[model samples]
Target: MINSTIKHLTFITLIIIGFSISFTSCYYDVEQELYPKPIDNGISCDTSTATFSVKIYPLIQSKCNSCHSTAISSGGVSLEGYNNVLSAQQNGSLMGTINHSNGYNAMPQGAGKLSDCEIANLNTWIHAGALNN
Candidate 1:
C-alpha cells in the first residue's frame, strides 16, 4: 500500500513538472511573437538621378512633410529637403520607420495612409537612385 501511494505521488509530481515546463515555454513563445526582431530587406533600387521637383518633392510635401518637416518636427524628425531625406536613409531611420509595423509610429498621424501608387513612385525613385534634381 505504501509503495502504491509513493508511485501515485511520483506520477502526479511528474505530471505537474511537465505542465509547468510547457506552460513556461508557451509564455516565452508568446512574448517572442509579440516582439519580433527587425529585418532588413535591403534597398529596392540602384543609383540613378530621379526628377525631384515633379516626382519626389511633391509626394514628400503632400504626404509626409506636413508633420515630418522642419516646422512641426514630429518625432524629432524632418523631411523638408532632399538632403534631409537622404540623411534619413543613411541613418537607417527612413526604412526602419516605414517598414516597421509597431516599433515606430507611422507618419502622417491621424491621416489616411499613402496610396499604393505614391509608395511605388517613392520606391522607384529610391531604387533608381535618390536624386537631387
Candidate 2:
C-alpha cells in the first residue's frame, strides 16, 4: 500500500500549501496609511463654479438652516433665502461668523467649525462677487 500512502502524503502536502497561500495572500495594503497624505501639500481648494444653488445653499441648509431659518431665526439671523444670505455676506457677518474671526460670534455655535474646504468654498464664492447664482 506504498502507492496509497504516497497519494495521501501528496494530498496532505497540497492542502498545506493551499492553506499557506490563502493565509499569506490576504494581507491588506492600504496605501494611504503607508504613504500618508501631506497636509497643505500645495493642493488648492476647488472653488471654481461655487454657485449658491449647487454649493453654498446646500451647505448652509444642512449646517446653519436648522437654526437660522425664517421660522426660528436664532440670534435674529435669518438665512432663509438668497436675499438674507446676501445681506449676511454684505454685512461681513457671514465670513466673520463662519471664519470664527474675533469680534464676531463663531457660527454653527457649539459644534465643530466648518471644514477648511467649506470655508474656502465660501471665500471663493465671495471673491467671485457673491452672485445670486
Candidate 3:
C-alpha cells in the first residue's frame, strides 16, 4: 500500500512539471515581437543622395505644411520653402521639435512622431549643408 501511494504521488508530480514546461515554452511576448528593432534587409535608406527638391520638399510638404504653410502657419512657423526650413534648422527648432526633445514643442502636435528613418534622412540632409538641391 505504501509503495503504491508513493508511485502515484511521483507520477502526479511528473505530470505537473511536464505541463508547466510545455506551457512556458509556448509563451510569447507580443510587444517585443511587434516592435522589433528596425532592420535594412537589403532595402536602402538613400540618405547620401537625398536632395531638397527631390527628397526633402515633398516630405516636408506632406508632414509639416498642413499646419506650417504660409496660409495658416502654426506657431508662426512656415515650412513653405527651402529658405524657411533652413531658418528653422539654423534656429535649432527643426531637430529639437522633431526629435521630441526638451525645450521645444513636439511637432505634428497631435500626430505620431516621425519615424527613425525619416529623422535619419533629414539629419543626413542637414549635415550635408541643408542644401537647396
Candidate 4:
C-alpha cells in the first residue's frame, strides 16, 4: 500500500511537471514579431531634383488641380499652368495654404494634407526661384 501510494504520487507529480513544461514552453513573448519595426524600402526623399514640370506641377495637378484648375478655380485660385503656379507661389498663397499657415486656408480641401516629401519638393522648387522648368 505504501509503495502503491508512492508510485501514484510520483506519476501525478510527473504529469504536473509535464503540463507545466508544455504550457510555459508554448508561452512566447516574441518582441520582434509582436512589435515589428517599420521596414525601410531604402527609398530616400530627394528634393535636389525638384523641378516645376517634373515635381511641382505634377504634384499640383494631382492634388490641387482638381479644384483649383482654370475651369474650376475654387477660392479664386488657379493652378493649371506654370504661370499661374508661379503667380501663386510669388503671392505667398500657395505655400501658405499648403503649409496650413495661420490666416491661410488649408489646401487640398476635403482631403488629407500632402506628404512631407511632396511638401519638401515644393519648398525646394520655390527656393530655386520657382521657375517654369
Candidate 5:
C-alpha cells in the first residue's frame, strides 16, 4: 500500500510538471507567431508631373492657401501661386514654417496638422527643385 501511494503521488507530480512546461512553451510560441517583426522606414519619391498634381497640389490648397494666400495672408506667407511658393523656398522661409516645432502657431493654424504622408509629399516636391510644372 505504501509503495502504491508513492507511485500515485509521483505520477501526479510528473503530470503537473509536464503541463506547466507545455503551457509556458506554448505562450512563447504564440508570442513569436503573433509578432513577426517590424520593417524599416522606406520612403521613395517619383519626380513626375502627375505625382505633383495628384499628391502635392491638393496638400497645398487644403493645408496652406487658406491662411497663407493673397486674400487672407496669415503670417505674411502667401502660398497662393507657384511664384509665392518658390519665393518662400528661395528665402528659406517656407521650410521654416512647415517645419516649425511649435504646434499652436504653425501654418494652417487652429486645424489638424497635415499627415506624415502629406508632409513627405511636400518635402519630396521641395527637394525635387520645387518645380512649377
Candidate 6:
C-alpha cells in the first residue's frame, strides 16, 4: 500500500511539473517586439516641399495632437485646426517649446525632444511662410 501511494504521488508530481514548465515557456515578453527601436535609413530627411497637409499636419498629429487636440487641449492650447497651429507658430511657442529653448516649456511634456531632422523640417516649413497649403 505504501509503495503504491509513493508511485502515484510521484506520477502526479511529474505531471504538475510538466504542465508548469510548458505554461511558463509558452509565454515570454519580447522587449524588442514590444518596443521597437527607431530605424535610421542613412538617408537625409527631406523637407523641401513641407506642405501642411503632407508634412506639417501629420507631424503635429502624431506628436502634439495627443496633448493639444481640440478634445483635450492641455494647458489651454489647441493645435486641432490650422488656425490654432498657426497661432502657436506665429507666437514662436511652437519652435520654442519643441527646441527646448530657455524660458519656454519643453513640449510633448514627458517625451524626448524632437529629432534634429524633425526640428529642421518644422523650421523649414515655418520659414516658407507657414502657408495653409
lDDT of 3 at 91: 95
Candidate 1 runs further than 4 Å off: 1-50, 99-102
Measured by C-alpha RMSD in angstroms, how accurate is candidate 4?
A: 8.2
Q: List the residue pairs that clash in candidate 2.
A: none
RMSD of 2: 5.1
Which lDDT tens digits does candidate 6 get at residues 4-119? 99999999999999999999999999876666543233346677768898888898999999999989999899999899999999998999899898989999789988876777
**Candidate 1 local distance difference test against the native:** 0.69
TM-score of 2: 0.69
lDDT of each: 0.69, 0.87, 0.85, 0.86, 0.69, 0.87
Off by over 4 Å in 5: 1-52, 102-105
**Who wins the lDDT comparison?**
2
Best by TM-score: 2
Local accuracy of candidate 1 as per-residue lDDT tens digits, 27-116 = 745554555432222324321333677777887788778888888888788889999888886776765566545676765577765544
Q: How accurate is candidate 4 locally (lDDT)?
A: 0.86
Q: Is candidate 3 or candidate 5 better by lDDT?
A: 3
How would you encode candidate 4's per-residue C-alpha lDDT over 4-97 as one tens digit per residue? 9999999999999999999999998977666654222224567877998788988999999999988999998899999899899989999899
Which residue runs does candidate 2 get wrong by more than 4 Å? Answer: 1-44
Error of 6 at 74 (Å): 0.8
As for candidate 1, its clashing pairs are 45-127, 46-127, 48-128, 48-129
Against the hidden reference, what TM-scores do the models get? Answer: 0.54, 0.69, 0.66, 0.67, 0.55, 0.66
Indicate whether candidate 1 or candidate 6 has the larger TM-score.
6
lDDT of 2 by residue, 59-113 (tens): 9999999999999999999998999999999999998999899999999988988
RMSD of each: 13.1, 5.1, 8.5, 8.2, 8.2, 9.7
Clash pairs (backbone) in predicted model 6: none
